[model samples]
Every structure is written in structure tokens, then in C-alpha cells.
Target: MASVSTIYTMGTFLSRAEGLGQRVRVLVEGNWITGTPLSCDGHGVILDSGAEGQFLVRVEAISAASYALPEATVPRPRPHEGSGDRVRDDADDRAYEGTYATVASLS
Candidate 1:
């Protein structure tokens, strides 16, 4: 049997993502809770979901979680490379596609 490399869990992901300033999607029921990772430990994660919005998700309740893959293309788009409207729209689509990717929390 191949030895497992690392223990991959939402707690680990949330803790790491918080440091990287990354947004994350937590799967609850059949919906995805999209938010920025504020803090996390072995038990739960606190998510900042915009203006005065924050939610704590228990480690066990987070059936799944994900972050966007880093793009090597460029930080920001050129003059007319990509439109913000399109980017926002695509975010939803990407989530449904099972990748469950989200924009970085880096502002």
C-alpha cells in the first residue's frame, strides 16, 4: 500500500488559506458557501463574507472546500484583456463545474 503523504482536511485548508489571503468555498448541504477565510483551527473556521458578515463552520460540517488555482498569466488584465463582469459570471459557472474555485482574498 502507498503511504499517504499528508492529512488533507478542511481545517488544514482553512488555516493555510487564511494565511495566503485566499477566498474559499465551503460545501454545506447542496450549496457552496463562498467567503474569505478569516481564521481556523482543528475544530472550525471563521469566514468573512463581505460587509459585517461572518460565519463559523465546523470542521466536520465542511463536506468540501476549494480554492482557485494560481494563474501564471498575469496579476491583472491588460487594457481590454478581460472584463470584470465576465470574471464574476464565470466564478459561478466554475463552482458548478465541481472545481469550486474562488477568487483570491488578496485585495
Candidate 2:
């Protein structure tokens, strides 16, 4: 199996590279996610959430685009009595926007 990396939004298009101007759909299964064109690398795709830190996804298969997002149900946040709304400071907000992806093949 070949490995491929990519960046994508929950319901938006996927970004192939830093500035490749290419977009595609993505499907994830368990710890393996696959997509077309297979980013320049063959490891994993970085998810673009306007957040920091790159997510490397190891691709297992690359055919028919058969994969689904992992089913994760986050519990509702408990309300705090006097906790001010959590807000990211200016610097923190800026740092959160940078994102990238790395793909690699195993075996």
C-alpha cells in the first residue's frame, strides 16, 4: 500500500501542498486516511483547522476513495459559574492559524 498526506476541512476541499493550488476530497478509516493525487509525500495528510502543529497521516490504500471520518462524539462543555469566556490571546490566535502535512510510506 502507498502512503499519502493531505490537508482538508470537515466539509471542505483538501489542500495538496503548501501552495500547490490543488484540492480534493478525503476519507479516513480508523488511523488510515486516503486521498487522490497522493500529496508529494506518501505518509499522511495534514488537517487544516487554522490550528498549529502538523498532522501526519499514513496512507494505507489509494483507490476508489473509500474512507470515512472517524466517529468521535465530544461531550458538551460543562458550564462554569464565574469562568469568563475562554478566549485566545492575540499572539495565540495568530499562532493557531499555521498548519502543514507530512506523508510517508511504511514497508
Candidate 3:
């Protein structure tokens, strides 16, 4: 049997978050916080919210964090030779599906 570890300690999360330039949505004490992660330590995390301001969110205040890859980073799939497939891989397909769903739902 293969065991999986889904639990992340605060220290573990901070260590993993270092140096990744991605936008993040953090849940803190009944409120949603959004920003780009700058740095994090045992005490807290620094988030840069463009045009708004940078925030020092304490570790204790954070309930959850979800990091999203910037739109510019996602590689746009080009049309393959003769196939009509819109995406190059499963990951791209999932991204496109979400975008298509959102656009469709608005109508």
C-alpha cells in the first residue's frame, strides 16, 4: 500500500512558498486575501497587493492559501499539424475548460 501525506505544517508551507512568483489567495479569519507572495518566515508572510499595498499576514491568521500561476506563464497551445485538438496536454485542457466555462456562464 502507498501512503500519501496531505498535511502541511506552517514551516513546511513557508519553505515551499519561498521564491515562487505566483499570485496567491489566502483565507484568514473569515476574510479572503489576495496578493503575490514575497517572503515568509516562522512569524508571517509578506504579500504584495499591486496598487493596494503590501501586507504582513501572521502565520496564525492564515487559514488557507491557494497559489495560481499567472496567465502569462501558461503556454498557449498552437494548432497541431492536422489534428483539431485545442490543447497540447491534459493540464492545458483543464485550464481551457475552466476559462470556457466561465465565459459561457456569463452569457
Candidate 4:
């Protein structure tokens, strides 16, 4: 029998991606989706999909996988920072106009 390669789960791949600061491309339901990996769990994977915004995808829906490395990329947000409702374009060094909510801890 031919040797079999170990199967890697989507969550496993995504977790590693978060550390490497890289984006991943996944094909789901005949659509090619590309984005920066944010977080992943047993149920789904979250991605920071550029202009399209973030996406939460179920692992079971993935059909294919690949890496999407952009020529230039934005720096990932700090751990303490909340979700980025507005993303800046590094190429132009300008911030796009958008509304973001401020989260306050009611301690």
C-alpha cells in the first residue's frame, strides 16, 4: 500500500496562520474566497477579507485550500484592540471614512 499523508484540519491550519501573519485562500461551494486568517475553532474559521470585510466560514464548507500572499499587506491589529471596523490602505497611507463603535468595559 502507498503511504498516506496526514490530514490537517482546517482549524489547525488557521491557528498556525494566525501566528504566521499570512492569508489563506479557500474554495467553498465553487466560490474562491481569500482572506487573512483571524481565528478558528472546531466549528468555523474567521477571516479578514480585505474590501469584502471579514468572513466566518464553516470548516465543512471548504472545498479547496491555498495560500494568498499579497505583494503588500497591512499590519495585523494589536491583541488588545477590538475588531477593526475600518481598515487603512497602506499604499495610500490614508484612512477610509467609516463608523466604528467604542467598546467600554462596565467594570
After superposition, which runs of candidate 3 have C-alpha atoms over 4 Å from their true positions?
Answer: 1-7, 69-107
What is the RMSD, in Å, between candidate 3 and the native fold over all Cα?
10.6
Clashes (backbone N, CA, C under 3 Å), per candidate, total: 0, 9, 0, 0
Candidate 1 residue pairs in clash (backbone atoms < 3 Å)? none
Model 3: what TM-score? 0.53
Q: In order, what lDDT does every prediction score?
A: 0.68, 0.38, 0.63, 0.67
The C-alpha stretches of model 1 lying farther than 4 A from their native spots are 1-4, 68-107
Write down the TM-score for model 2: 0.26
Candidate 1 global TM-score = 0.57
81 Cα displacement, candidate 2 (Å): 8.1
lDDT of predicted model 1: 0.68
CA displacement after TM-score superposition, residue 56 of candidate 3 (Å): 0.6
lDDT of 2 by residue, 24-75 (tens): 3343442333333333344545433222333344343323232323333433
Model 1: how far residue 47 lies from native, Å: 0.3
> What does each candidate score in C-alpha RMSD?
10.4, 11.9, 10.6, 13.9
TM-scores for all predictions: 0.57, 0.26, 0.53, 0.57
Please give the distance, in angstroms, between residue 24's alpha carbon in candidate 2 and its true position after superposition: 1.9
Candidate 1 minimal-lDDT segment of 10 residues: 98-107
TM-score: the better of candidates 1 and 2: 1
